[model samples]
Target: MMTVTDLDCLRGQRRVLSGVSFALDAGDCLILRGPNGAGKTTLLRTLAGLSPAPRGALSTAPEDLVYTGHLDAVKPQLTVAENLTFWQGIYQNAPQDTLNSFDLDELADRPAATLSAGQKRRLGLARLHVSGRKIWLLDEPTTALDADHVARFTDTLQAHCNGGGIAIISTHLDIALPQARTLNVADFAARQDRTADEEADPFLQGAY
Candidate 1:
């Protein structure tokens, strides 16, 4: 289980989130919906332990965490399999056959830089299957994916949740996600006494 207690976030001198709190149990898949600057990524970063501590408490299995952001975070020069192998050494220890689940076996020997944008998105997503983590934090996961890859991603997400894994995704495109918890940034801002676009920053790149 993942517990987030009264989390607060600061970007520069601005308070991005104040008294932000939530809990994620196994089987929980939360989707964050906000305008351009709603602080979704800030929240994700905080949850991933990459940001400054918030005002509240967070008690979770730190090691059981997997975070993938807008950036691919993969070595551009490395082969697909080599990249996976490197991440496996640091992030997971899944069976070798798990690569087949993502239909990446054929591309294993290919250089990561040579993959198409959609292919890279698929490659990024393939990490979730191999990762033995309990919690997944994804930001705009469908960034460069096409219809087929998106469908595959949705199925993969369903399987992960079915297997007791929790995921938090922030995206612009809406697809049917089973049993998901949707938190609107508009509502969040209203409660926080801010304007509609005030809290939704992801849509606006300069905010980041």
Candidate 2:
């Protein structure tokens, strides 16, 4: 189980998050929603361990977290399969044909930079298949994805949750995540704004 105590974040002069608290047990999904600069990305980065914890709340085991952002985190030069291999080396060994399961078999040899946005996202999603980590942090996960890929992502996420994995996704899309709780960060932090240097909230500006 992963527990996030209170997360206090300051972006520049603004306090993006103050005493923000939430808990996610095993197999739970938390959907993060907010406006353009509601600190949604900042929170995701903190969860990813890519950004520093400012104050109050948020304690976690770094090894247990998995993060995927809008950038896809792919090596433009590496082929589809190579990227998976690299990730497998970092995470745990993946199940057989994990790429195939995501309908990426045909493009396994294609360079990640050459694929469309949706395909790249799938490759990023495939990492969860073998990551073995229980916590997931995804940002803008559904951007540029077609219906089929979205369905696949939802299915895999549901399976992961069923198997005791928890996920926190930041997206504008409204997919049917029955058990998922959608929280709007904008509602909580829209009253304030700040710069990264001021509060050192790097994730607020795609630090990771």
Candidate 3:
């Protein structure tokens, strides 16, 4: 199980979100919903431990979590198969059917740079499967994906949850995951007025 208590998130020196709390058990999925700049990414980063949470408690080990942000994290020079293989090495997990898993069989030998945006996104998402972690913290996972691939991604997420994994995704699209519950980050927006220094910080005003 994973638990969050009174979580407060910041972007640089400014607090963007506060008093957020949630809990998830195995086989659960939580979808984060909010308008742009509502601190959805900040909350995800905080949960993944990539960013410090000024005030909160996260009851999960770092080893159990896997985080995927907007970037695909692909090596442009590497072939599709090589990319998955590389991540498998990093995660120290057994090899997965990478080609078939994300419908990249035909492009397995092709360089990642040659692939289109959607293909690169698929390759990035496939890393989640290769990670073999219990908890997933994803940000805008379906950004460049078409409808068909989005469905494929949904199936992949469902399979993960069915196998007792937990997923927390931040996305604007209406992804069809029947069992997934939604959390609107806008509800947790920090109510404090920003100081002059915070207002002048570009990092705070930009996407959190």
Candidate 4:
């Protein structure tokens, strides 16, 4: 199980989240929902250990966590299959059905550089299957995906959760995941003095 206590995150010098707490066990999915600039990505980064929590207790091994950021970490010079193979080598375990899961079987041999934005995103998502990690931290994973691709990705996430894998995703789109807990990052925003104009747009309170 992964546990968090009073996690506070900052973007540059501006404090974003304060007094945030949560616990996640196997087969659990947690979704972070908020408008852009609400620090959803920041919180995910903090959880992934890419950034410090400042003040919090996070229980999880860095190796056990697989983090997929907003950007597709695909190498333009590599082929789609090569990319998956690279991760497979790192994890030393890869799901046999990973190719079909993300509908990339036909594109397996294609160079990642030739793939479109959505296809590159699919390849990025396919890496999760080969990660062999207990926990997944995804930030806006549905980017560049069409409706059908989104549903496909959601199904993959659902299966992972059903198989006792943990997933924490930051996304604005409704993924319809089973038994997933939603976290509103805006609720944990730090209370501080801001100009009246800044206060008017509540969504602008936190930096992305």
Best by lDDT: 3
Best by TM-score: 3
Query: Lowest-lDDT window of 10 residues in candidate 4?
Result: 199-208
TM-score of each: 0.85, 0.85, 0.91, 0.90
Local distance difference test, each candidate: 0.78, 0.80, 0.91, 0.90
> Which sections of candidate 4 miss by over 4 Å?
193-208
Error in Å for residue 177 of model 2: 2.0
Candidate 1 residue lDDT tens string, 1-208 = 8777777776555667777667778899999888888888887887888888637788886788889998877677988888888878877475576566666789989999999887787788777766778789999999988787788788878888988999999988885776898866444331335555856766664443
Question: lDDT score of model 4?
Answer: 0.90
C-alpha RMSD of each candidate structure in angstroms: 5.6, 6.0, 3.6, 4.0
Indicate the worst ten consecutive residues by lDDT in candidate 2: 187-196
Ranking by TM-score: 3, 4, 2, 1
Error of 1 at 5 (Å): 1.9
Once fitted onto the true fold, the runs of candidate 1 whose alpha carbons sit more than 4 angstroms away are 186-208
Better of 3 and 4 by TM-score: 3
Kindly report which residue pairs in candidate 1 clash with one another: 36-200, 36-201, 36-202, 36-203, 37-199, 37-200, 37-201, 38-199, 38-200, 38-201
Residues 1-208 of candidate 3: C-alpha lDDT, one tens digit per residue: 9999999999888999999999999999999999988999999999888889999899999999999999999999999989988998999996557678799999999999999999999999889999999999999999999898998889888989999999999987886877899999999999877678888999889433
